[model samples]
Target: MTTPVLEARGLSRAFGHVLALDDADFEVYPGEVTALIGDNGAGKSTLVKALSGNLAVDSGEIKFAGEPIQLTSPTQASALGIETVYQDLALAPHLDPVQNMYLGRELMRGGLGGAVGLMNVNEMRSQSRVAFDELGATVRSLTTPVGSMSGGQRQAVAIARAVHWANKVVFLDEPTAALGVRQTKNVLETIRRVRDKGIAVVFISHSMPHVMEVSDRVQVLRLGHRAAVLDAKHTNMEELVGLMTGASTKGAA
Candidate 1:
């Protein structure tokens, strides 16, 4: 069998007296969308923070591409080609799509200009356009501030930014939180496209219907522990909800 692109074994984390995650196990395969679904305070966010290197686990093992690794910070995770798109989208309200995409990692000009720390605006703009286009993002005017775009468009830009730099996996936390029906559909499509491109996608959401529709596999977190990992197609909503609420464990794959 082919090794998983990303895996976590016996992961645990705590905040003072509260045990956020307890011996959690997770895996994300290439070209697949693995949905991490659970109720609020079920350690979904904690696990995400740990995986994305925002929070350190008290005990666990993380392997990326079959190699053991440690991620102490978000910068370390990003350097390992792991990108995260949080619920807020994390775009500069005043900046345009191109500018937001190249926020911290800007291109520098060659020779004397590079030595002086001059940004290569033209190159950054061109590359951002290509990345957005590849993600099928609808940015009619790349020059307009991202704050002015619709919720769906902003979500698309955030996803594009992750996929642009992430060679390993993309962790999306509540990507379709407050959007309308149409906007939610658009964002979900973008997510599927991201997975189709052969990058592993860890989709964290509360919407069970959306999870069922988009995920190839579903990992249920209940009380900081993995209750079940089931095939998305074979599992029903009732089974998922039951597992999450500590009522059922019939389906564990």
Candidate 2:
């Protein structure tokens, strides 16, 4: 086994008396997609929030690249090469693909010519195009506003943006939740491309078939705890559903 690119041990979080995550343990490797599957209130949200620095962990340790680290905020996580794409997409509807891709991380023209804080439009466009091309994203027009693009196209842009800035792990929350069949396939392929680029993908989804198809491993959360981790190829939907619902106690083989 190889060292995990990202890992959490004994991760716990609480909302008043409710224990969201209870001594949870999770890990994902580079070049692989680890599907996080569970019923509602299974603590998947808490676990991911802790790892992504959206929520503080009550008791746990997060290690990145074999070193102990503290992710106190989303910016801190991003600084450490962690990027998350939420279900809402967090995109500007009025902005074009390039505009959305470089939203907050826009490049500023440097040197004496950059004294006035001019935006580096051409350079940003070039880089965005390269990222889209690399991921095989299907965007009809980079100049078109993101709101006008199809859901799949917007998803592609979101993913491309994440891939461009991500150096280690990318957390994708229900990436294909609102897509059609073809769009879902496109997003799934884009995910594979991300993995091919050697970035670990933490995919959260309720779709069993999607998980089984895209993930190298599946981690099931149950009642605020780590239920089981199964090899996707060897495990079937029945076994995974069983584990998630507390019908089984089997861990990864």
The number of clashing residue pairs in each candidate reads 0, 0
Worst 10 residues of 1 by lDDT: 244-253
- On residues 111-197, what C-alpha lDDT tens digit does candidate 2 reach at each position? 866788788999999988998999888878889999998888999889888888898999999999999999899888888988998
List runs of model 2 lying over 4 Å from the truth.
251-253
Query: How do the residues 143-248 of candidate 1 rate in per-residue lDDT, one tens digit apiece?
Result: 9999999888888888899999998799999988877888788778888888988888999999999999999999999889898999999989999999988888
Residue 91, model 1: lDDT of 95
Q: What is the C-alpha RMSD of each candidate to the true structure, in Å?
A: 1.4, 1.4
What local lDDT score does residue 189 receive in model 2, on the 0 to 100 scale?
Answer: 89
Q: Write down the TM-score for model 1.
A: 0.95
Model 2 TM-score?
Answer: 0.96
Q: In model 1, which regions exceed 4 Å deviation?
A: 251-253
